[model samples]
Target chain A: MRNRTLTTITVVLAAGALALSACSSSKKNTNGGGLGGGSSANNGGTNQTYKIGFVGALSGPNAQLGINERNGATLAIDQANASGKYKFKIALNAQDSEGDPAKAPAAATALISDPTVVAVIGPAFSGESKAVNPSFCQASPPMPTVTASASNAELQNQGNKCWHRIIPNDNVEGSQGADWLARTGAKKVYVLSDLSAYGAGVAGTMAKELKAKGVSVVSSGVDGTTTKNYNPIAGTIAASGTDALFYGGYDAQSALLAKALVAAGYKGRTVTGNGGKSSVFTTGAGKAGNGWYFTCGCQDATIAPTAKEFTAAYTAKFNTPPSTYSPEAFDAANLLMDAISKASASGTATRTSVLDALNKEDFTGITTQIKFQANGEVQSSSLIVNLFQEKSGAIKGLGNIKELN
Target chain B: MSQSENWVQQLPQNIIIGLEQGSVYSLIALGYTLVYGVLQLINFAHSEVFMAGGFGSYLVVNGIVGHRHMTGVMVPLTVLCGVLSGALTGAAIAWLLEKVAYKTLRRSGAPKLAFLISAIGASLFLSNLAGKLFNRLPNNAFPTYFDINHQLFKIGNAKVTLIEVIIVGSAVVMMIFLDRLVNRTKLGRGIRAVAEDAPTAALMGIDIDKTISRTFVIGGALAGAAGFMFGTAFGVSNLMGFTPGVKAFAAAVLGGIGNIRGAMIGGLILGQAEVLIAALPFVGAQWNDVISFVVLVLILLVRPTGILGERLGRAA
Candidate 1:
């Protein structure tokens, strides 16, 4: 009787274990299939929901920036969905890229594989976007992508019509940055790059332009991605005795450099490319970031009348003011939706049709007029340069938004 | 003005800079070796300890010091607080790990694979935890406490900053102190004994648990110091430790796991190799990671036990 009872207990325990294993395997499959299904199926009916994929650095060091961009895209989608303009609802499939170039390809591949995905919104950092661009271009029927944050010139060099950016490339932004330094009558400028492709590329271009304009480019240095202490480099800037300091990098290192420069008693003007124009920079560097300037492709919140509505809606929904890239994201989503509408009207909204629609797209966005050049460069005005104020610890619009002729 | 002459003149300066940078790596590598020596385990979370230490220093400098700019008292205080916090955190984690993961397994005589899997899970958990806690924004700067721009010395054409001198000098001093503690102390002996043969050491009256806990504290303290220095020197973020932790682990392995002096030598060599690789033309800067990993793989292939063999014990 005791032996019989033991055998029954053993059978029940084994059955439970098998059930748990089966459940775990199913969960993994669901996660993988969900991403695939979410992107592939457009709800396939008259009342179908159209999906747009967004890939960005949502969970790493740049999570805040990524979330802000995602928020802007969400706002646009929500508004469109609520407007009842189409036969389908808009759904977003957001994935985190972690701001790494290596991770961007995987994220891009995941988004591109989804057949129902009409367009991709972003992979914020220029380096990541550039890395993923080729993979996107090679996709069957070629995915039409609109980056909210990427501003590198090289991205447009692909010569593919599938890519349309809402943000202006760094060429305009870099030229604007150079012009700002030159307009201030700064004779000598010290330049430092983060040593990444994006940073080195922008800093090199800025330096070249500055040098061509007869401005003395003194003391160029390269910093590693892991660089935290900017004192040694900051001291070089201080000692170089340049009128202004220009850094081409993201906010983390840029903020530290700003603080280090101030600590080293550097009283000169400071400037950075779009990558440095994050709220984290202001928060991290605090008073040190004050009076520092950054040039970005997007207009400041104050400059965009439409942004006031965006700000109100964003703040009400997310409980925070949108970051610098928020407007660009809004523009990208709206621009894509415009393309989608055009494509659907023409015929079945296939990838090739969407790509054609994107190329021919010309709509006035919240930030600026969204139109793509033959090279996939956004035909738009130059970026606005904002100055970070020490007292407010916030970036203030500096009345320097330049239009590219 | 000749190319060869310029190259000759630059060599000594480059070496000095390389050595100074290598010293920082060595300090972090020591933590990796200490943990591996006693437990026969790699604490992937060590880098997070380094990151946490940096954040700890940032908090101390920003909150307590109340200075946005570097001041004289800020550096030492930050480092002190950083090390304490790191050691405390490490000790707590080591204890918890033993209680929750390793202890039951040790009793059951579980396989080594289980421990490794558990360590990886713990690492991912801690890293994600930090990401959630820190608002996931890359922190650009911690408050500077001192002017790092002052030149301490010049080697021919190369100029060395005061910060470099401090970093190298402090790292060496700490290493020497650690060497003495591990070689000449009773706790050190027990740690060495356990690494040699855990069951035998247990039979010989060594308290394996206590030794392991102490080993973790020591490693954590070293990592903490590295974190403080790294944050003050470079910057800190949620994912800051991932790459460096991998590199330091590589350094530990290259120096021969469970070997102290090997770790020191391996770290300095790796740091210099990375710097030199970055300087090579055509290779460009982006190839630094590629070069480091290739070198690591090659080194492991040639010398499976690393350059120093595991029998060197805990003496550096």
Candidate 2:
């Protein structure tokens, strides 16, 4: 009787373990493999609820920025419904990417397999944007996506036509920054990169443009995203005594490097590309980041007359001030809605029609007048060069957004 | 501006940087070495042990120090509190890991591969735990107590920062203390005996499980201390452990797995090799990781037993 009971217990435990492993294995498959029940089967008729998918960071340090972007898209969807512009009621399936490339493909695939998602607003960051491109592009008719802010030049080079950006690519900002710095009479500049797909692309492009403009690049090194000790690199910078420094990375590391550079006796000017335009950048550097130049594709919304209405609407809706990239995200969301509207005016608005409309998209948004190039890059007025001053330590815009593609 | 043209100019600073980095690797490597020495199992979860130490330090410092400028009594006080918290955290977690993950398996005479997989699962669990608890930002700089970059002195053109001084000094002191503990003490004999022949050691009146547990404590303490140092210098993050942990493990294999001094030597060598390769003219820093691994592969190919040879692993 004891032996029979033991055998029964063993079988039960073995079955439980097998079931557990099977569940874990299935989770992995959904994340990595193709979505089994493809998107087309779920496409509802004109009266069904349509979702404009949004994917980006929503739960980390950059959470505020991503939330603002997501909120912007959400607001656009709400506004479109209120206007009664389309037969279908539009909503948002805003997935949290947490700004990780590893998490992006799954998010993108999930969005792709939702047939009611007529368009996607973003995979907001450049790195995540790149990772999710395959999902959008490889879809049968291709899902159209208009990004709020992913500006890595390589994204356009990927030949992913379905993915469009309202913000000028880093190629514009890097080239313009390099041009401005060269015009400032700096003989040499040290270029530093975080080596992310975004940072490297911008820094590399800037270096090429700097060399072309007769500015000598001293030594391009690293300000690694996770690296804390900047002294060694800073020492090299001080010893090299380059006339200026161009950092291509996010605000946090840029600030850290700026402080390190100051401590190492570097008195040269520092210029950060689009990625380093947050309050964290300045605060992290303390006094060191003051007077540093930061470039971006969007002007400060508070000062722009056209942006005033959007800013007020945003504040009223979200009950908070718009953060960095929020206005850009707002414009991007409107761009998507506009594309949908244009596609539907002539005939039934489908994924292919919406994508075709986005390809030739031209709209005067609050930030810039958008026109996409053949590479799916937005043609903005000009890239904004801002100074991280004591007053406007969070990247004060000097002029218009650049790179009309 | 012309620094890249002269390889000699870049070499000294790179070497100093390398040594500072190697010190952290050596501390973490010691954990892997000590555990591997006795159990004949590579404790992959040891990295998470180091990572836990960092988070532990961060919480301690944040609670005690708040955000204050570095100076006066606060500097040493914060350091002491943080390091202690880190060490305790590391020791406790590592002990629990051994108890929950490995102890039962060891008693059941599970295969070595099972231990490896278990260690990996434990590592993932701890990392995710930290992530969930502390939002998964890439970095969260501890409130500045002092400028870690204030130059202690210059070696050639290299500016040796205060942080490097702290890292190198603390690592050396800890490594020495551990070496003496392992070589000279009565407990050391028991540990060595158990490693040599556990059944024989048990017959000879040494408690096998106790000695193994104590070995973990020592290794974990070292890693915890290293984690604190790494946090102060690099800023604490959830993903911080994996890279350094892997590098330290590489240092372990490169030096001679299961050997104490071998890990130290391997770490410094690997660190210097990485820095030196990155200091090369043009395309330097871009391929540093690649070259570091290449050197390791080359060295292992030349000497399979590593520099000091496989001395600590039990020979069946």
Candidate 3:
């Protein structure tokens, strides 16, 4: 009886594990996909309505970036439909990849199988981009993906040809950030990351470049699963007595670290990769965020000339200013829509026609003129550095926002 | 300043940071352990109670501060309002969870698994409701009214900050108060009697339901208070309670599920381990959580009743 009961327990446990794994590996049913300024809706009707698939994190720690992308896409779609440019209505079919690579394959498969989905706007972060690449490239008459801000170079190294990101790769962010650090003349630097693929990628590259530039670097990783106390990392950074501290992580932890660092009385200038450039970082860190500089390739209303109207429209629509990469997200959507437009102008725009159109396009976007190279990289992608400061006791750009050439 | 200069020198500061964090964990853990003590059922919805407290705090803070900095009187007043609202909200939500979610299961004499499933459903319902009401993204923009991070004192390389002092201070006061209430008060005796022998306590005219409800309120209030302290340090979000909830559960199990004092020690130990393990050069912070569960497993293997829990006959 005992042996039989043991077997039964094992079977039950195995089934439970399998069920959990199956559930965790998929998560694509989330169609409302935008948690920030994203209108919650179901599938666009099966008739007369063309669908654009948005595959990124719609609900997680990384949801802010994805929502920014979704809002941009939604904004673009709303504009095109309103303009009566296309005879048919375009609807967004946004899926949550949870910003995780494991779930990306299922989302990719779901997007590829949808007959109405002519093109996709994103798999926002670099790791998710890499996860979806092979599946997207391997699809028959491969679908094109235009990403606003997935900066990892490995996504391009896969030679998927189906992936085109307007933003510069991690190499650009790392080298550009290293240049700024070097320019500040900080010989000894302390670096830290949340240890995510994106976080580690940017931090590792920055550290390597900083070392090559004859700077001494002390680096560490913090637990990013959830926002725990960041005081230890802040303490280590302060105790190190580094001239400056550079972080390669998201805004939430950056805010906490900045708060702790300020409390610890660390006088060094705090800088971060693209992860820290968002308004979320500034708001999250509050007063302690003052005088901290961060670098990003993502276009925001505050920085881009092309984004002024979009920002105004976005603020009017969402009642809040768009975050770091919304403009790039808008540009990316425009690029994809442009391809769809090019394809639709011909008889029928299948996934193949969209893919073909994506390769040969020289589309000009507000953030930058979108042009793709052979390896799906932008021709000359760049990064901008901005500092957070106190203006009228509110944490914002204090004086003039300086652009690092 | 390089990595070569002994990392061990910073251990004291790391420990202090860990204790502050652990204090927050202990606050949340008290709720889970307290509910378990009386009902003998895990209340998964308790995390939602904690999250509710955060939203309560966010609303109060939003009303009081509204994106502007305040000096002197406004700071303490704002914190007081936020914490009180948060505590009250947490208490109300805990009472509701008992009434709406678990009370039926208890009355029906249903199996424990049924209660667990219902608790989980309630947890998801509350989380999604919060997500829908508030934006799903991290609502971290609220200004901290009390901006006290100045150095309080120093021990070796570790400097104590005012924020840490407040966090540790509030947590210890609450824990001590609850411990005294559980051990000394008339209601405390009733709760202990119910925990010790529910049927017997009921026969003795001790109101089991009332005692259980009171226990939940106390736990919920402490958790809500902790939420305000935690939100002040880390920002609040709809999903904020989850990780701390899980860690606090681990802390409870490590401390012996029904033992209040054990939960406190467990939270502190877990917090210290999370930091110290991460402090080790190559293993890093990622391994800290893994070490936490491992420690729990080792403790269970060595002493199934936990450090403070007694023999089977003396379980209470």
* Per-structure clash totals for the candidates: 10, 8, 0
Best candidate, DockQ-wise?
2
Give all candidate RMSDs, comma-separated. Answer: 7.1, 5.4, 5.8
lDDT of 1: 0.70
lDDT of 3 by residue, A1-405 (tens): 544543343345345545543443244343343331243233355325567888887766667777777877778878876776765667788888878898888888888999888888888887778778778888887888888878775777887878888887777778767877787799889888788778888888889999999998888877676755677667767778789888888876787788878877788878876666666666677778877776776554665666788988888877878876788878877787778778878676788898888899998888777778998887873334334443322435322223442
**What TM-score, over all chains together, does every model reach?**
0.76, 0.87, 0.86
In angstroms and one decimal each, the interface RMSD of every candidate reads 10.0, 7.3, 8.0
lDDT of 3 by residue, B1-316 (tens): 3453546888888888889989988989889888888878889988888888888887888888886878878877887787788888899899988876777666666667767867776777677667656756664645755556867889986788877888898899889998899889999888888888889999999988999999889888988888887877777777888888888998988888888998899899889988777777676665766877888899989878776773111253
Cα displacement (Å) at residue A319, model 1: 2.3
Deviating ranges (above 4 Å) for candidate 3: A1-50, A58-60, A75-91, A96-110, A300-323, A380-405, B1-8, B65-74, B139-142, B155-157, B310-316
Instruction: In model 2, state the lDDT of residue A189.
Output: 88
Q: What is the C-alpha lDDT profile of model 1 across A31-65, one tens digit per residue?
A: 42354344435555576656688878766565666
TM-score, cand. 3: 0.86
Higher TM-score: candidate 2 or 3? 2
lDDT of 2 by residue, B57-171 (tens): 8888888877655678878778888888888889988898888777867776666776776777677677766766675565677777777777888887767888888889888
* Native contacts conserved, per model: 0.21, 0.18, 0.37
Instruction: Judge candidate 2 against the unseen true structure and give its global Cα lDDT, from 0 to 1.
Output: 0.76
